[model samples]
Target chain A: MYNILEFTRNRSTSVEQTDDKTLRSYCHLNDTIMEAYVEIAVTIPDLEIISVQGDVLRPHKKEFKESFEFLKRVIGTRIGPGILKIVNGLTEGIRHKQFAFMLEECCHAVILLFTKEDLLSSPRPDDEEESIIYHRQMVLDNIRLYNRCAAFAPGSRIVEGIIPKDKDI
Target chain B: MLKFMRNKIVGIEVKDSNTVLAHGFLDDNIYSIEMNVLIDINHLEIRDIDGRWNRWTTTECKRAIPFLKEAIGLRMEGDFSQTVRKVIGRRACRHFANLLLECCYTAKQASEVLKDKFKEKHDVNNVTSENNSDKNVTPIISADMPDHSDTPFHDKPVSFSMVIDLHMHSFPASPCSSVSVDQLIKEAKRIGLDAICLTDHNYVWDRDTVEDLRQKHGFLILRGNEITTDQGDMLVFGMEKDIKGIISLAELRKEVLESRGIIIAAHPFRGFLTVGIQQIGLTLERAIKRPMFKYVDAIETLNGSVTENENRFTEKVAERLGLPKTGGSDAHEVSRVGVYATGFIDKIKDEKDLVDAIKEGRCLPTVFRKHAGLR
Candidate 1:
């Protein structure tokens, strides 16, 4: 139930706490999925993932939805049946990607982490990496926007009051 | 008894001896057979093979198979004992040794629980547990080509270097598979290697050897370890500590990613035993079904010293999958040090960057030595 969502971390990951609304506005610029994920992540005990929310994220990321559905289809399959197809697909994709990395001379990927605690009402297995990545990306853009907005509204207690404790850092 | 030739004029027979219980075929004549004494069934096994001990067994014969095989072996060994020295060649010795080893391994395995299998043989245990258990990847010795080129051999070998063999007990540590770390490094330097991973089975290269060598050679030595999982070997970079027999491949992946390291599939295409590659007997036919390109990262293009067919089979799989492939020496010997290397096209000036480049797939696998190609 505990999480420290990342913002594409660097050496300077904040050791201090900051305002909530400001965080939302910051993550929204990256994508709706992250925004939605972060919005639900904090209230782990209360939030329930409904079809309505799923539909919202589905529209936001068609690729993720397609990948997720295909993954779901493989749940009950015996290891031998779909393993070849899944493995071949993965390796072939990687092969093409490797060639591209050499030719392009660079490589990039966007990864996200989502915890089952936020998605499930009952206890379930959680992937901390997925949750952290999801929240990190979720916070990235919104943090950028919030920083800008806070710069102008310097007097707002919501932004200015979360003191950056030197000791905590 | 089955008859070979019919109507023999042996004075002992009252009737035609060939016409008995079951039927038989001959030169324009058919006959039956029933009574049995001893069978010389060399013909029926595959039909007319000259000198084979092959025979078809009924249910009755099945029960006695184990004892029959042992009896035959003991009889042969005893008969050859008196002057076996003159006739014994490599084959006889090998047969004798393999039998002994099988018996020893079987007895040990039966007495102990499977969990206790890795004890005593610390080096092998470390390698086996750390390199192969609970991992989702099998090392495949295969060659991969880019879409731009269907063939890997069209161009000359690419040149670059990255960490390899970290999981092995380094040269100064335990000498198992091939060469010492020192010899490996020397050979790599001879070829003007930009870097040598210097990793071994499961343990880290002793810190002093690396520190001394790094200061002297001025080449990049990346941190690496080859992990053993249930599926196969995973050549992992930028981590230390034994991850062997501790977690499943699924679990390993989570840790590997979180640690910000790269995990490459080791020799995915070469089949023996590591992953669930079935024993090659009645099960060989089922192999053609698994398209072979299923899971994991960069295939091992050149394993420092396997046969050409092993390498070629791997190459075909990489082509079929269009996967970003890599090569490693899989070297345990010093001479094989730089035999297989990876070329990272990135600005990876050192170990960390090298990992980033490989994880990103900005590399080419190459086999510098012409030791093997396709045989």
Candidate 2:
């Protein structure tokens, strides 16, 4: 027997400090052969997007000329609350929704980069039990991290007793 | 690589003429749950809810079992799923919330089916008296029942005489902000804010525009800058210089000192708690040693954008440091204008008065949105 359908998607995000005051975040998404990428430069502390650049390498449709230009609308947006709304509002008219997702991913990567050190600073747990307890408390303190990763997936040990806030009805 | 799968099953049965039983089972690689809810079909209200965690990962998972009772009186109506999530999911586990929501949905569907069956039976029996069929039939479910989800949880309005949102941004100045000055002012007035301060990132509202907005709207408008420094963000008041780009905390402190302005740490612990302080070993003692605390005059303990834990951590640091705490919405949009504000004990007539109030510690944090329940 042969499989009827097979599909795979690969997405990557990287953040690098380009200058003393700015950090550049780059995101790429590739579904089969079609690909898209977004690069955003944001100022530190404020995390305001000062510049944006991206392209849809293999357009799903012929109207690829202006598909990536819509990302410019998020140039001044800060990586904070309501960012998803801002990005969605900007790309509402765009044909390729993946571009918007990629842009949002870049912004989130920037945020993760700033806090990477804090995460790294955590003491390494000695055993599986200690690791589970540490991760559980981590998600408890930051509910937003719930179900965001494999370790925090529902039914996982880390999120066993945690109740979801249910931001969306 | 490892493959994992989760299976969830929900079933609804008509237990009696007026009661419906909805049960759900969830089984996965690491956890298993079984739950049953008895609902009154007449009112679509949950009468009883019982659940058991068959296979669980942690002991805390059992804590959610008690919260399941909170759904007993909840009517499966408008915003029913949301209410269930808030009451059960938020307190113990989201999985339980999901299961209860699934049960509620299934029960509602089953009730509708029962109602339809009853209506059909009534129609068959009243074939001779077609008009009388509606006379004796009572509606099992009310149509378009109003839900109190929109009602404010708290009725007490903010009693403060002078409430000012000290941190706000406007478009064109703070490029990141979507709300323009006009929209910000309109929203501030609409929400009954006594005054609003525009603290755009590294940009200050010009005096001319501030005066024009004040005169046009008949509302007090002040200007400040949310200066980005090497250490962290600072809300600087009484400074008129348009210090572009990021500046060092020491430079900002020097400038504020020269100008005799007051600086409030803006969400100082914004991302700290999210990183899991215990794992990182960032204790209160280590947090207080941050360089930004040494320079700021006050702390923003209540910020709209920060999580409650982050705000509490900031409050703790402020208490330990004996620094006065303030509040701000950090609003980039109009609707978020007065979510949090600073209440002045003394009337603040101008920027100077506002600066003096902060310097004198005559202000405290106030929550304007009653639903936040932070007051």
Candidate 3:
């Protein structure tokens, strides 16, 4: 059999506390080769963007090259709800949806990393059943974590039968 | 390691000359659901539907089974996806909706086959002639659902005199916000908000513009600023200074105190509840020890941007520290303006009244919209 198409994409994110009050997060996307990379520095607690930079090393299209210029627009903006819309509005007119996604992912990684201390300080569950119940309740408590990680994806044990409270009828 | 997998299988059978039965089975590591939908061959409308959950994760999963009845009269026609979403997806399990959509798709294909068979056997010119005449058939799902038209946007607590969304941003002031000032006011009124405060990041609304807006819309529009301090964000009311960029929390506190303004810790515990805290030793005692808590006058316990758990945590810390709780949509868009709000026991006529209310602990966090669902 002849294969008509072959594709594989991988994304990795990392955060480093550059200073006592600053966190720098980086996201890299690779589709067979290096496709896109974004780095953002935000202040702790406030999570406001102090600096941002990105490059489309292996462009999916030539229009994506213009995406780097719009990165400055995100500076001074906080990494929270509506950030994606803000990024998309700032990067409009360029085929830069992927770049916007990468920037958002970088912001999300910074937020997750900032909360790592709290996660590490939580008490451990006694058994597997208890652990499942604990995690399920955790997702229930914070529905924003839904589909954020593999463990919370739809149909996963942790999120199964969990109807989002805000689902518009 | 391979951790989880899910399988969905669907089958369609001709139950009779006028009926087609479509069966859908979904099995995974954590859930097992089987559903059967009986579809009319001529009209393509659902005649009957049934489902069962052999294995489920939560007790609430069973509550979704009864919602399946809403799909019985739905037609597998134009905009069927939206109808199914409104009917089966919203009030109950989305997995059930997904399975039902799949079964409907298969039933649609089976209906096509039956139509073809009818066309061949009866020498019919148009098997869909009857179905086409009922093109405007409205599904009963929407009418059967609870009416929210008369319901207030937020669930207000008794004894509260005025409701106000204390945290909101607008375009040109807060670059992240998509809504303009005019749009925000209109949306706030449309959603039944008694009043709204524009608390843009580092930018305070002009007093004249606010006054004009209040007069023009006949709605109370208050002014506040979301200051970015080194510690965190603070919603400062009754401050008219147009401060920009990040400042020290101490400096912000001193200024607010000097101006006789009230400061609220805005989503103070955001990102703290993203992980499972059961495995972490971060308790309320440890959380309350945060330095910023000493500076703010109140805590935003029902912020739209943060998770319910985060809001609850903030609420707990507020209770522990003897601080008043407030709510705000922190809305960048018009639609989110009143999702969460502050219910003031005393009437707030202007920014001073708002400040006085917060200073006197006359306001409590009230949720207008249950979920902001923003990311």
Candidate 4:
């Protein structure tokens, strides 16, 4: 059985170390070890990083409604801005899979975001279960590896599609 | 489900093998953007010392709506049985489009490209199961811009490629190994193979041979080399004409960079080639020591020559390192060229364009053949 675990990180600076993280699954479904990190693949001229603070937290908030809004800006503007964001407000509950910080205890959980789009986009897909190979890989990372949304994970948002819920998928 | 959604106006994002792809919606749907398939041609322009993003030269990418429609239309007919066969058909469509672009280069170059394609596919009327399908021979032609080039694939073009090995030789290849260059060329021409790199083991002989073919065919023949090191084997594109001198992996890396070549760790964990991609060579400690994997451009995630597990492991390592992923057919025979080929979305006029695009990290590699990327 392939374990799908979705996670998120706020920003690069916030990420202390990715090598420290590993995906050790319990089902013995092939030890799929996962590692997460960020990268700066492009140079955005005068690119500004809008901090999500104060009144800047709406859907289209100057800062962003939810923190995931930052990813939308990157759609056509820049391709991969592997930015790192700190995961704060751990108390905030998201709608997708259950999300928490510790990797030792949680399995099959996700770094649930406030949006349905986020929920639809974060789970790892079994081979052939998803249409787009790329979208499947992203979901696979979240399932077997790491984050976005509250944290500035490079894979914070995007890649929305239907996913089979069965483990056999 | 994809075919079900007609005109959904789907969006695509292209990225390098190492660059992590991010999306703002559907947290559950985020996917890894393979570097081999990410070619942004619409806004691509080779930058010079003037720091100006000038067009390549004498070309224009007319909205290829009619041809694109026919290609899709044929696929929509729904009688094709083989995935590989259908892929071949799709490849032809792409070749047709590429030939149209070739018209912008030079008359000689354009003719070479068309002739190469025509010659290869000249007599093979039974490629597909139904002989009638071959009757729909569409000849594509156009005029070149000559004084200038058309706009590229994207505003900030990204490129991705798959290594389609159709008639290549390896170090271990026996004397009777496959040398079906004609077959490979035919497939390339039909599939609209953007660039062909003949990295046959340590020598660049294939490069020269392909070059002649390219000059006659109009396809980009990248000077290629497969460096065999104690660490393992590596495949690179865009190099000097002769790959005779013995160069260490480090030196090879430098040389490839100097010549504007892109290096990819082929089949990282499979066979001896593993010694090349993984910093640690044969040990599991490969990625552990480097901690940064700075020497590699991308990882071979899909090697058509090997098993799915090999591809999976390659992808797993790439994902682990956060490096982008790539694929290749690894075919020494021509019939299997595009099996593991790449699709770069750049308005390239020649070899230099591909090398430049790859070096700039404008590439993506993917397994989903139907996934339409950014327009």
Candidate 5:
């Protein structure tokens, strides 16, 4: 239903080993005659969302600002299962679904960056290592579930953190 | 992505209804920074100046102005941000640096728009003339252009884009500080600070060391000291004589006032923390009403490392007294170098300009949100 007119993603790491790595995403969307650009940056190793700067590029794009600003609710969100929850809640009140999809696209790019960092790889001995691994795996699995259900009916409830009623016992 | 055919001019204007900021490229290389601010009762109009690299206010600008002139002349054949950073580095005019980069990006958008307009009108020769000339004159909005409701959120003109934290503690000087001077400098750069003052508790930075750091980093590092008074802590700048052993508030005031120095009540609202039933520093209610308050230049309205209630109380006290307000991080830790700052309308070159700005009420207290550095 929507076409991506342009898209770019950039990944950069600091010179130090313990420093944060950042991923920046920019996308241009075209639905009919309307067009807009979305820019987002996220830092990993601590999962701090920097900024989401986007604006529609046409005179007819007057009514899209509220939806675009909703994207800013993504700031300070960590890249985990909670990130998707926050993004969904922020975009729920938007009049346009295109902005929501664009936000998801940007968020997903950040999650992929976490995966590229091998967040779910083996862990060495530490006080909280196992707990940290469990949390990361949960986030990865939650993202998988989200991708699986993305094609479902828009308003259908995909209950999170719960077992389905009709599932096999 | 829009590809640049040649050196293009870009404009960035961030404005609210009453306060308007209009600045960008005046020529292909020169930048014009201007602001018309309306904060509370203050109405200040910042004027423009000429000369490419002669008259700069901050130390960073002083060091980088010549380099910028040379660098802008070089053709950009590769990544622009990296090239620019390599030339000027991060410590030089950080806030203005961000503004310049945004202007370059906006120029690309403008170029694309002009290309479309040219295609529609079937006039190729007129495109460059129309776009380039308009930019040369003023990259920002014209007098006749109507107020558009669709300005980009990030592009909105901010009231005081430049902020300098005037109260800070470094590890070597202040025993209470947890962050080293080098770490503090790094964080200040990351937070895009225009300038910073190293004001350790009861300790003055060595003049030679301060000059050495400023030279090495190319950032404005002002010399100041946080004096622990019997009444409270005071941030004093521009003191020509020694103030090391002055304990009485009245005596300190006399010396400071005589030497044309300025003092600000530092975190008076943040009463001394209690440890084993022993409390220190003057309370907010008592500090503002003290006779010493009358002698000080300004009240520190926002202290970054303090609680919200403390800052609120400080703001109320300042407002009630009709005193000019200032802000600082009071940063003992490196992570909070620029969470709060004092915003000055005019560029500050030295301690005297800083003192003058406060005395003339040309400065405003400002607080940035938690993690404002990311934005």
Candidate 6:
């Protein structure tokens, strides 16, 4: 078991050093009752998405697995200001808002990993482009806050980031 | 087969437009088909009555002839074949379909004559005229759009005075682009660009908004789309609709050919990364060759985001294939605007003019190290 974890860690390191134009990142959101994960492969210098794989694991594990194919449609997406809307569009006919939310969280985490840390809070003026990036970061930051909350209470309500303290789950 | 061989069709030798070709048996006087066609391409009209069938009188086949008049308002250029198909291809009168096609061929010849006269009088070979008729099709004298022959024409003047970036992305539409339209405009103006084209991934900016911005900023804005094809990416101009990531190279080629649109291969040598399998050699050796290379108008030899080696490889392939070359900044962020551009000898007024110039092979790729802040 320990060797398997170490091999996976070394494999990810090898992928990170593969190419200057391509970057692969993975994010996992987990709790007691349900767990969600997403892996995003994107091009650098320009964030053209190559592929995405994601899934939700809940009490209805079979149904959640069926909805996993939603993210596959976002293969050739170019991630920019409208990332959330594209994510929402991926889950359009599935009528799965929970899937959309989790997929959005995964997308934010991948973008945050790719973006330079200084650019996140560069003190730029509140223009439309700058605000859109900031909003993406805020959602990522809120997910971190929620993960910390879920650590203590595994089944705590997931708060909607824009409206403070409003439980969306 | 014997009956078809016995049927005799005699085309009368007449110099007039209302000439008729009659079909009859060798000895019988009864004529099965009498086709009278008058074609005037300059006026863009075709007059033929619909042919309908009646078992009692054996006259239903004549009703399908009027459907040929649907070709009245169509131009006899890129859409000539499509217009012919829509008129008499499948559900229409199968018997008279060949007759309608023959009429169209005659109409096309007339249009060619008019086009040559206009070209000689105005020397409007490379530039689009103010008249709306020239907006869709270039002159037949300069009928240089897509031939799949891979013939290279190096006749353009070496020195050009105008510079324009042919590809860039805008926020909200290209979800991965970090630059907004306002930011791109400001950056292009600061870099002394004569014009800039917005080519967001799979999306086009509204014409009205681009026109308003062009007037306000006093800089030219050409509309284009960076279509994501299965082979790679392409920069397409003169496509009225957005077919970004959904179209294949073959389908895109047919659509672009019919629409007379210009297509340039975007960053043809940019290699993608595969897990655990590294491309150890130069990009030129490992680059996935696009099968539709012959159909593209030109190769984007200088993309700002790609490495210098990759750009050089693209140039080498383009030279070997006898294709013209173009360049673009491929800017997703604001600061990268005008990093690379295509220089044209003649000034371009709109997207149509730009497409004509590229198809004429009167433009060259240029690199701008100063504007990209690399200097």
Task: Name the top TM-score candidate.
Answer: 3
Which lDDT tens digits does candidate 6 get at residues B217-266? 88889899988664467899998776733455667888888888989988
Model 3 whole-model lDDT (C-alpha atoms): 0.69
RMSD of each: 30.2, 15.4, 13.3, 25.7, 26.4, 29.2
lDDT, model 6: 0.53
Instruction: List, residue by residue over B6-39, the lDDT tens digit for candidate 5.
Output: 1212232322211222234321112233211111
Scored against the true structure, residue A5 in model 1 reaches a CA lDDT of 19
DockQ scores of all models, one per candidate? 0.01, 0.05, 0.07, 0.02, 0.02, 0.01
lDDT of 4 by residue, A25-132 (tens): 111101012122112111111111222111111122232223233222221111111111012122123221011111101111111111222323423323223323
Residue A141, candidate 4: alpha-carbon lDDT:
36
Which order, best to worst by TM-score? Answer: 3, 2, 6, 1, 5, 4
- Number of the candidate with higher DockQ, 1 or 3: 3
Error of 4 at B23 (Å): 67
Per-residue lDDT tens digits of candidate 1, residues B1-375? 111111110001101111101111111011111111111111101011011112211111112222112212121122222212112112122112222222222222222322232243334534321111222211111111001111344265544444333222354443344456666666666666567775555555555666788787776566677665434456777665566332335656777677776676665433232111221121223322332224345566555434344455566666555666677766554444555666666555555776776656777676543323311
Candidate 3, residue B337: CA error in Å? 2.7
Best by DockQ: 3
Fnat values, one per model, are: 0.00, 0.03, 0.05, 0.00, 0.00, 0.00
How good is model 6 by TM-score?
0.42
Candidate with the larger DockQ of 3 and 4: 3
Off by over 4 Å in 1: A1-169, B1-95, B101-169, B172-174, B206-209, B271-295, B370-375
Off by over 4 Å in 5: A1-169, B1-158, B272-288, B369-375
List the global CA lDDT of all models: 0.34, 0.68, 0.69, 0.33, 0.51, 0.53
How far does residue A18 in candidate 3 sit from its true spot (Å)?
18
RMSD of 5: 26.4
For B262-335, candidate 3 gives per-residue lDDT tens digits of: 88999876765555223234478867877778888999988877765577778888999999889898887765
User: Over the true interface residues, superposed, what is the Cα RMSD of model 4?
Assistant: 24.6
Poorest 10 consecutive residues by lDDT, candidate 4 chain A = A77-86
- The residue-by-residue lDDT of candidate 4 on B158-214, one tens digit each, is 453433232244323222235555555665666655655566766665545656877
Q: For each candidate, how many residue pairs have backbone atoms clashing (under 3 Å)?
A: 66, 2, 8, 105, 3, 17
